[model samples]
Target: MSQPQADEGIQTSIDELGLPLSETTFVVLDLETTGTSATDARITEIGAVRVRGGETVDEFTTLVNPGIAIPATVTLLTGITQSMVATAPPVEEVLPDLLEYLRRDPGTALVAHNASFDTGFLKAACERHGHPWPAPPVVDTLRLARAVLGRGETRNHKLGTLAAFFGTPVTPNHRALDDARATVDVLHGLVERLGPMGVHSLEELRSVTKPPTKQQIAKRHLAEGVPEAPGVYVFTDANGADLYVGKSKNLRHRVRTYFTAAENRQRIREMARVVEGVTPIVCATELEASVRELRLIAERKPPYNRRSRHPERVHWVKLTTEAFPRLSVVRSVKDDGAPYLGPYTGLKEADRAREALLAAFPLRQCTHTFDPPRRTVEPCVLAQLGRCGAPCDGTESRADYTAHADAAREAMTGDPAAVVDLHTARIRKMSAQLRYEEAAALRDRLAAFLRGAGRSQRLTALAVLPQVIATRPGALGWETGVVRHGRLAASAVLRPGTDPAAFLASLEATAEHVEPGPGPVPRATAAEGELVLDWLTDPATRLVRIEGEWTCPLRSAEAHAEMTHWAHGRAPAQ
Candidate 1:
């Protein structure tokens, strides 16, 4: 047996989606067929190379019997004559081996010069043979070449042209294996070209060819100076007013994507056409970038950003301060000590949470404003149906209603044990009865309840913590922040060898410039609270100092198997 040929300069790792270039496995492939049209043609030969972290790992090359005459023109074009494939295995045999080789690793990405052409033939072959096809992530070097190369760089985008342009050691000889080897070189070359532009992951590489509109292409230079690091970016019009604000781990790549077809939103395209320049604020971490993006959108109220533009729009499920105390979805959180649960994304989610709480607790359902001394009142339907205590009709005592309200408050702000227990039993009963739709509805309510209650408990815990400093390691240095009463007070980048004492002193100085208020809650907006929660929960971040205890007495009601069974509507694991 002969050893497979190896390609060079392919090993380097840049991680995205937790899988880096160095760790990824690629299968570069090519096919020679009986004709140009995949619909009419049959594959005569298949060639491929498997590479991992820049080094060639394995090679596959085989001639396939097409069970059709080799046209003279096709033979002349590919140099694969009828005699060459006379004794070779059929496509059915060759396809299984090719698929098996590709499946040797989980992170394998299929690379081809014109991927659709080759992939089309392979898919047809699989279907004809009744064999299952694995549709792995495909990277088309032809599309990538167009995206990376300028018009003057290549005469035309062709496999041989690219092979010659990149100076690959092996030239394509119209043979399957030789062309595939050349394509492997081209793939690596294009990936190297894309690295600086922040094309580091499989997802980015696959979507690189989404061509920008003509208007967007002209304004592409606006992203020229954007850094390739986690940060928030603002797009501004000619008048220097902000048009749109976004955050990304790779600022340059993300900003560039706005001009490309990858950004499909019409509003974004309109914003892109008017964008004159970009302003980026480099942050210590992605969490910081996300928080800054939310705050910027809220402050600027840019027309392009729909979400986070109006933090006040997010509804909260609040227990009213009225004597009856009904559960209602309200927009604002008051300074008064009433139990509030949410920052829910919309009215629907808040209503779902409210319904779940109502199902579990018997609180007043009427929307009446009552005075202490009233005449005979007509009871509402809920009161007549025994769902309520008939507080409106004055049949229920104020003390009895108060007790029910307290239970609801506990379910909303503290332990959701009452709500969780109720839903779990209902879900189990429905599941046993095979009432799938009802079970699903009950499951959704339970999920909403737990989500709201958990968020409230988390916010309450963080709000009570007066002062703390959190730190995480980043690309440049340590990312440090001083959070007072759960609101960011100060943030700084601490370079190594710089004295910790000096950094802390400067951080304290910056803290004086910090905005006041932990607010009435731990976070003013849902986004802000989410950022704090992410920072606090990150296993990598260390708490350097604290003025008060950071703790929560309440726990999420999701410890039960019911949630696990019904989440995503999947059947429970045996």
Candidate 2:
């Protein structure tokens, strides 16, 4: 079957037409039912009035016959008895005309006191008659009343009580048409109270609240000059101190949301009262915005930004250069000539990576600072169990122990093939002996080593570059940036009509002013470098220009097809 025509369809139009609430059309409806439960009872009468421009456009009222007997309690409450509806048309017979009446205006908003009750019975009736139930947007007067009038202003926000309080022209007396007409008056009264807030649009009316506290309403002007572009924004107090720093794809929407009652964060709600103004720094891409946000939070030490303010606290897995070389988790990557594997999330992950590396190579597992040729020391239990080289005692030669230490360093920072092959051979031997638990443990270690080594290699590769231009697809056009050492030096958007050569010239000038970093590498720099690597790895990203080569000289885990086969227990490639 074909879809119904737009004008004749049951769908309600929500287009605002740039019109105020007074000019918008609303259909106030009411139903007289046999009982409260829609499933157990039936609608005995339907009453509706369509109001537009503060005047009635149309009114519809009809008696509907329920095939079942009406309960006596319903007759007393609603005055709609079986005798009154005995000769009326059944609900199935009246559905077509009712839908047509409701859809007379394509852009109508359906209204009722407790909307769910009437709309529920109407929806069931339409579904029963095989009519396409176009789900129209609803405006519940009960919610509107509670939101607009405080408890002291009205006795209780019931239909009859509200109508009496407003002195509506029509009084509701357990009758459908009278109740609907009274509801129309109540709607207009509520909207009249909302006019001062400049909430003229239907969308605004649907979300309107009682006049907000003076604090929340006064801060609305802070968002007036914010742009509809990707950027980082700062909220500052009256004392010129940073309260919060945030980033968003749309600066205007994100900043404005903070000044509304809808903001549930107690801290932000308190911040709104003190926020004097917003400062927006537009960026070429959201990636740049995120990097800028991290930098601003770290520098300004904003009280509201608790997460990324301490990137320096992240831990790294470091290999010590002592005589008995072993792994240790350190807070910073110093200039000490030891190979570093992370900037991992925390000490726990760094420890796991250290364990994986130790599983493959028998490096000294002791905590002691070794004095070579000291015969007073005994070998630790790990040395007797073959988990470490017995360098504590004189059993392992210096040359032999140095070679093993170099192999461990090579696996983490150089080739990685030595550790990869060792774990592979161990896993295979365990499987052959039917030692499944041992084999599984070896495979997990290999996976952890691969994950850490791959990330470290990629980050280290990007962190050494002097300057490069990276581009990714965006909604407006190509989002491009010039990155120096791992930091975003300058950024630009290359739209369709933009001159590519001119864009590069401006970017190069900006890059020149930025002291090109082969700067001290910190955990913060590594975290930002991950963002750059993500853009570079995308197949769609085009490297428009480069001053230095981007290379991962060491073999990446992604290069080995057989590694995945062995990891997943699949047959090796032919």
Candidate 3:
């Protein structure tokens, strides 16, 4: 089915009634969907190739928010995520914009693969978003595929296999807009071979988008042939440069629709300018297509691809058992295994918590703020109120002061055993001194040990392990997934591969500890681990790698509770 590029698909009728060689405008539209049923699924990406006569022109591509979280598989297939789309101007915002662009001529025809899916997505998106649905003149090469290639030409009429059989040059397959553009190439080839239709006028081509006659509908299905059986396809330029990529169940029909639409002027124009080829890959199922598309996009980072552009980067507060410790903030997790705070949004948020520690705990204000005596008099206001365990005045013994500093450091940094050790030490000292009141306080804090250690459930899992975390790769966002037992989970989101040992180390001060030989057998997924081992074991090694992600996970009760709290307004820091 092909519709006019506008509500009307009247191409310019010229001298001798010839198609506009460079003026017969057409839009090649493509849709990225949730599933096979265009009626039930939402569109994630929309691209179209514009063409005039036989010359390609321009292109239009956009990632839609879909008003829902993209499935992990879908994200993998299209590289379209909930966040990439979060700020994406909505479809309603773009549809009108597209309409205005197409209305430039007011009579161009619209084309798409299986035109129904893209058109369906368009219709639904318009209706759902409070926009009017207009019928535009359209064209479908799916009809051409059947008529030109005939019913018994191939076992299946897949866009790729068909292109391959017909000798169309396409490679690096399957992306929404890319495939739509490629289908145009196929359509042109077919039309060239088959000659003009019975109704050769632009009006005749425009009639394709309207409700087809029963005979036409039957013929349309036959032309659609065996649905491509769900797969991914890629659209490329004449030089094989990727312009767009896409996926669908029936590649033949889906690819065919784009060649027939008229509203696809922008896309058609873009494709005409850059595209000269296509590539398609059939998947075992729709799910496979979605998954493969995402991975391919993520890896390739195509010119038109979006998402993971700026991976999540966070500022962290470091808490260490090292000397002169209080609370220090940095931009990333540190190395040296001292256990630091976060990859948070900013220093201000971390500062809020730092203030709480200074007010509530009797910890040293500064390591050397009083060194050499800056005031020459009092220990400033901190010592006056006993808030400072007194590094400011030089009155407190180093032994006693540093001990309290260590304990405070423990609390601020969220060290689990640190709580246990502090509690035990305080209890022992109080017992010797007969200070039962202080000892009891330590006991209560110990009971809340698990509460503090829990840290509001970073767990992304159900009653399971944490999963679905985000990380940064240099300046890009990446997501890593894990499987605990048989259940899938996303775990430990980080940035830039988590290989910056110095960066992670900066988050915390390390206590100079001597290791007892080469530690136990290592079984951790750490970039540091990979780098260090490679450096030491084989100095010649030039390669090292890391990973990260962010998403809802199947985690333990503790983590699930935390994420739930965060998603709502009940977060701990809040």
Candidate 4:
């Protein structure tokens, strides 16, 4: 590798360099593949120009028999007919010859117009032949041209366009040799434009524009169809292995949103390139979609998807069993013997609830601890305060403690509205009778009910637990995207209709199924919480109705049943 330098001898080799350039050499290559994708397409042509020490020392260009009929679209693009490459040297025969010519002396880096596309084809071809190219840095002249000439000067950076701009002409046709020559001229002009010392070396040129990679095309994108179907969808490769899973109500529309509206091109491109196919499953309802989504995430555990390893790490409270049972907070849900109340966020909060119930109205902390044989340690603080309706005193009956324990547990989970009404009535009676403590207890109970009521939501019956729910309102219907973590695993599209065929279609289309779970409860007060409640309870809530694609839920009994199973778990086996 050599370049013309100051005080250099007047020689043909250095003179042929076309400029006083750097020692770095470049291998410019081109290919005609059977298709746009490297993996699915075969290469039919190979062309290259090797420049060492700024001199075009060698050239390699040939048509390779790709062993397959070149698609017409590619033929039109490259003009290498299926017949032209049919009898040419096979890739195995020519690749060796091509490599030897290009890699003989000081190794030169690869160069191409749209490097990502060419590299993809070459990589796929080489990998298929079991002879991968060595990892070499790339020098993209397209980028060099763009930088040397402002973007405003040219709309497209093709060789002929640049050649015309610089007035360095080529006489041969659009063959590999001619294109490579034209490209070299473009490179020379760029170096001159940048100035000899301007771009110190070819290495500096490579530094400017890195080669391309697989890019998601803009063809499949549909800008307006986001918030698509509320069912589940699974993305897969050609091998049918699940790459990712998701649920959406508007099936067709939501898939398009990723390709169209998603802001992250890198992520979308990865998803699009890897997603060779899609699997869609319509759920009975949105709730079922949620359940299905979780099931898919947990089951598939696709590479990109993640979530909390232990659900209870978030916190909760549980009620354990005993004659004088304790109401305590548990950090994790375990296979403990008694029915549990929650898995709550803070022990301090749990303690506050405990004190509220005990000081004003004392109850036992533990049933087992107060047992006759002294179950464990000495009875705790409850026994000291007369707070314990204790079995330790041998006076507390199992039935009496059991009733009080059940009442407290019910106060936590049972319908707070019903409890609120009861407490309100009792408080009024106490107030009227002038019994302050009684009225005060009833007032506290009523307040607790009101707070709990804020957490409740009445979703349509097709809902379930152990799932995440997302909603998208469409012209035809509500589209729900059910997901767990970030990957889509399953979905359901429930339309309002009586058509049994459509109903069954919706059920069968479900991506993956999950056990239904309750809707998320409000953890804090905000307009968002109020908004969700209003949307749920609003009688006028409506979805845009699409014709044959989806029907309204109002007209379909099958959708109703599907929605119920989705919201609630499937009926207990028999």
Question: Which candidate's TM-score is highest?
Answer: 1
Candidate whose lDDT is highest: 1
For candidate 4, the per-residue lDDT at 258 reads 47
- Candidate 2 pairs with clashing backbones: none
How accurate locally, in lDDT, is each candidate? 0.76, 0.74, 0.48, 0.51
Better of 2 and 4 by lDDT: 2
lDDT of candidate 4 over 377-461, digit per residue (tens): 4556767777776555555667877776676555444433334445455556765676755665544433322222222212212
Model 1 clashing residue pairs (backbone): 10-54, 11-54, 13-22
After TM-score superposition, the amount by which residue 58's alpha carbon in candidate 4 deviates from its true location, in angstroms, is 69
What CA RMSD would you report for each candidate? 14.8, 18.8, 22.1, 26.8
Candidate 2 local lDDT, 428-498, one digit each (tens): 78767767566656665565566566667777666667777888889988888887766778777889888
* Span of ten consecutive residues with least summed lDDT in model 3: 565-574
Decoy 4 TM-score against native: 0.34
Give per-model TM-scores: 0.64, 0.57, 0.33, 0.34
lDDT of 3 by residue, 202-291 (tens): 434433333223222222222233345567767676677776666776676555444433224444434534544556777643434654
Error of 1 at 436 (Å): 1.5
